[model samples]
Target: MYFTDRGIEELTARRGDESVTLEWVSDQLRTFVDLHPEFETPVERLASWLARLDDDELDDE
Candidate 1:
């Protein structure tokens, strides 16, 4: 498994039952970027991917 999977698993385990809005997630991402500029690119990519997820699924139909 990828090393990043550990963090993903932890996130799932810790917050799996919580429901959050995209706005909140976006705010958190921005806050994270503010604290860790070095992760800006990956975070940007992740945000873009998330923003396009529904459109991407539409393409499969």
Candidate 2:
């Protein structure tokens, strides 16, 4: 598994039962970026990916 999979697994194991909204997730991402400026680019990319998860254009890239 990829190194990032551990964090994904941990997130799933910890909050698997929780139901969250996109707004909530977006807010959390923003807060995380505020606290971790070094992760700004990755967070922005993640947020964009999440926001366009269903977009066909993303598949072409």
Candidate 3:
């Protein structure tokens, strides 16, 4: 997914000093999907898959 500077800043702020959790990141991705349902298949599938991955898995990506 593409992130604007503001979006990245917001995410960074939310992430704070602690490592981000998969569940938390997934919730953000789900909200993004809910807001933008018109995106193509693989993007949707990827987002869904990302929602299921462990935090370390996501971090590695």
The predictions' CA RMSDs to the true structure, in order, are 2.5, 1.1, 5.9
Root-mean-square deviation of Cα positions for candidate 3 versus the true structure, in angstroms = 5.9
Q: What lDDT does each candidate get?
A: 0.94, 0.92, 0.72
Model 2 C-alpha RMSD to native: 1.1
Model 2, range 1-61, lDDT digits (tens) per residue? 9999999999999999999998899889989989999999999888888889899998999
Total clashes for model 1: 0
**What is the alpha-carbon lDDT of model 1 when measured against the actual structure?**
0.94
* Residues 2-55 of candidate 1: C-alpha lDDT, one tens digit per residue: 999999999999999999999999999999999999999999999988788779
| lDDT (Cα, tens digit) per residue for candidate 3, span 1-61 | 5657788788689866788777876777677767887754656688767566876676776
lDDT of 2 at 17: 100
Judged by TM-score relative to the true structure, which candidate is superior, 1 or 3?
1
Candidate number of the best lDDT: 1
Candidate 2 local distance difference test against the native:
0.92
Q: At residue 47, give the lDDT of candidate 3.
A: 73
